[model samples]
Target: MFVPCHQKLVSAFLLLYCLHLSAFDFLWPCPQKCICRQDTLEVNCSSKHLTVVPEGLHISARRLNLSGNRLKTLIRRQFYGLTQLEELDLSGNIISMIEVEAFQGLKYLRILKIKNNRLKIIPVGVFSGLSSLLSLDISKNEILVFLDYTFQEMVNLRELNAGENDLVFISQRAFVGLQSLQELNVDHSNLTSIPTDAFSQLQSLSKLRLRRLNINVLPNYAFRRLHQLRTLQILQWPSLETLNSNSLVNLNITSLVISNCNLSAIPYASLRHLTHLIYLDLSYNPITSIESNKLGELLRLQEFHLVGGKLLRIEPGAFRCLAHFKLLNVSSNRLTTLEESAFHAVGNLQILRLDRNPLTCDCRLLWVMRRRFRLNFDGRQPTCSAHERGRRREFRDFSEAEFSKVFICRQAGILERKLQDVMVDEGTNVQFECKVDGYPQPSITWLSPQQTPFSSVGRIRVHANGTLEVRYAQVQDTGTYLCIASNAAGNDNISASLHVRSSSRNYTPPNFFDESLVETSLPPSTNSSAQLSSPFPFDAKTIVIATTMGFLSFLSSVVICFVFMFLWSQSKGQIKHTATIDFVPRSSMGGGGEGGDTGRFTMKLI
Candidate 1:
């Protein structure tokens, strides 16, 4: 191939220009002020004093965070070439408007968050080519109303959050094409009434939250077409006064919450078709009473919360039909009594809250008090004045003697106790105590491993306070000791092992029982009124035992030392030690408790 000299020069210059451009793009994929993560393909331009979207970004970038900037408007092709972007966060920007086809080629985007921006109107076709979009959060913006096809291009969208916007009226077809949407949040808005066909296209919607809206009434059959809906929450709607009959008919929801509404009674007819409902929360309402069979058709209901209502009474069989009911909260109410049959058929009840009610003390709550020991009804049981005594006291604190006239009560069984293992050296003492609390004043007795009664011997004693003490312990005292507390209700026992080890090298103790001691050496009387003025107030028997144990321990130590010295003396000179010095203090001789003495202590070793 032959080429002219001038043509070759032109081709070489063009190749050099292309190479320089490639080098520039490789060295700085993002703006100097922004931070780029090459490994994760993420670009963070947040708070970078940027006024416009950076022109060039890594082609493989997946997440782009452009929040906290002064970008005012998003023109067409602002994000021209980033095709692999899956998450784009443009929140906390001053973007007031967006041109149509602004995000033209972001076909793989799944999550787009433009919240906390100044966007007032979503121009049609703004998000045109976001085919794989799943979640779009445009909350906390100045958007007033939804125009037709505003979000029509995002067909794959699943979650839409338009909360905290001034959405006054939603056109009938505003959210028409969002067939895959499952959750819709329009809370904290100024929506007065929801059109009957507002949600006509949302067949797959499962969760709908309409909190802090000023809507007046929920129209009839408002949610009849949403067969897959599982949750509907309308919270903090102070203006929600009337709910028409059959408004919520033919629904299969599992949970429904209508909190802080001003309804005086439950709209039972409206909820008759929710047969599959499991949780219903009507908290902060003014519902006065709960009638029998009002919600009987909801057989699978598990938790029903009527907290902070003005409930006066719960009629018989109020919760009889809920076979699988687990929790019932009626706290902060004005109920006086619960009919005996209110919870007749609710066998699966696990938690029942009835605190903060102005209940009157009477025999109506006798069953509740008895069942308290079985159920986990640990919420505050009300305090009321005793009918006979006219004094206020807690429900559990009322004694069986006080309530004997009301009903025949049985004794309480053993609930809980603690027994610890005893470990000590031989010749040292050990004390084992057992505490028991039950009705009819349980009788406590200690026994050995052979199930025989513990004998009160010279080195063993059972105090009246349920304490067993063993003095001058031996290796034979290592065995299981059982404490049996018996009453009319039942008998419960706990056993603990005592381990007594020898004070010698490589000496592991064996577990044994010592029942050979005589049964005549009982302890002294335990008077309750004895007071001492000094710190070291030791009794005569305790002092004698302590001194004898101490002297024996010292003598054993000295004998061991003498044996070692005698062994060493065989290899060297004999080592002998002697000491003799004695001087009696004048105070000990009863000389006005003062002493001035001098003595010379002598020691001789050979």
Candidate 2:
């Protein structure tokens, strides 16, 4: 095996490197109770009931989790040798104090979480060495106040959460040097008032949440320095009642929510400067009225919520200049009447919620009722609140009768009527009556078959009972006749057909028979021969014709009775007839009657 000299030297160097790596792996020391993974440079000493940081931790560890422990204090130089530590989690511990130089040597630390601890105050210079810290969470602590320059050294801090604390005040310059800070959440704290300069140095902050505080009034220029703020939420401020005009006069926030503030009215002047505002929520207030143009300055506003307000009325043009507005929620109010012009300016509204209001459902609110299908809102239908009767009924449940009663100031309209056809001989007179039921007793007018006014026609006459009588119903009158009934409200019409027949002399009147003949009549031999003599010139066939005609008349009488009963049933007993009608068959008209037997029909009045 003759190898080159350079190959031999390389082989020796490889063996030495392997030995050095093994020695380094075996020499790294781990704390007795903690588990260390040298490959990942991570350590977990959680839930060990450890009172202090164990010594001799691996210097290569980057993440050290010491949560769920009994550690009471974080002493100075606790992590002296672990300069490469990036994350330190001391959450769920009883840590109350953090001494100076506690994080003295870790310069590259990026995240530090001390949540759910008993920390009362954050002393100055406690995080002096951690210049690369980006996120710090001290939530669920007993922190009372934020002293001046408390976070002036963390220049690269981006997110800071100090929520669920007992913080009462924040001194000016508390966040002086946090140049890269983006989100600051101090919600669920006891903050009474925020000094004007508390957020003066937060030039890059965009989102600020200060909910559930004791802030009573927002003074002038409270948040004027936050130029980059886009979202501001100050919710659940129990004592907050008033806001000055200059409080938020300079910010360019897009979303603002000031709910549950016990406000009586909208601070329109304070919000007049937010031209770029889009979403505004003033819910849970006691606002009674909405004057016109109250929120007209928010041109770009899209959604406006005023839920649970005691709004009684909204002046016309109140929601005027919102060009891109879409949603409006004014539910749970005390509105009695909403004029049609109230929503005349909101052109692009897509959603509207007006439930739980004592709205008076009348003619003025008909416009909203017409658009009920487009505005799909939840809850029961709105009811009328004008008088006692109006209160018992919902607007959607109105019937024709109910509407007539409520809107009685209008004119009359025909409700019920009948138009029956009449038949008469050409020389006889016939009448047609249009009996109608209306409120104001409408006037009646008739038009002849030629469309000429009945009053102008010589043969036609109108009666006081709305009946039109034609003295002689000639063949020309055998067409449709129109009857018009009119009043102030409106007009209605009905038409009747007149069927005229040629005059027939064979239709003779029946003579009275003797009572003795009807009770006990003898055969036609001697006693009745004189009474049965023919009056017209006829042969023996007249007897057969008369007997047949008598039989037919009997059948016709039965048919007429059936027809009369049917008409009575169909009319429901509301018939108002001045005369009765009788139908006679063609055979009853003797031979050589006028106008040959048409074999169709001839009407008669009895």
Question: Which candidate achieves the best TM-score against the true structure?
Answer: 1
Q: How many residue pairs clash in each candidate?
A: 1, 0
Model 2 C-alpha lDDT per residue in residues 1-606, reported as the tens digit of each score: 899999999999999999987886687677888988777888999999999998988878899999999999988988989989999999999999999879999998999999999999989878878789999999999999888878878999999999999998888878888998989999898776775688878999999988888878899999867999999988889788999899998899999999888889889999999999999998888888888877888888888888888888787777777778888778888876666565535456777677678765555565556666565455456666664556766656666566545633233343445656888876677877777655335668888778877773466788777788877666667888888887444678888889988665533222235554554333445545555685656556787899899999999999999999998878896555454445434555455556543444444533
lDDT of 2: 0.80
lDDT of every predicted structure (CA atoms): 0.80, 0.80
lDDT of 1 by residue, 58-114 (tens): 878899999998989998978878888999999999899899999998989999999
Deviation in Å, model 1, residue 431 alpha carbon: 77
Decoy 2 TM-score against native: 0.56
Output the lDDT of residue 19, model 1.
Answer: 97
Cα deviation of 408 in candidate 2 (Å)?
A: 12
Q: Model 2: how far is 316 from its true place, Å?
A: 2.2
lDDT of 2 at 508: 25
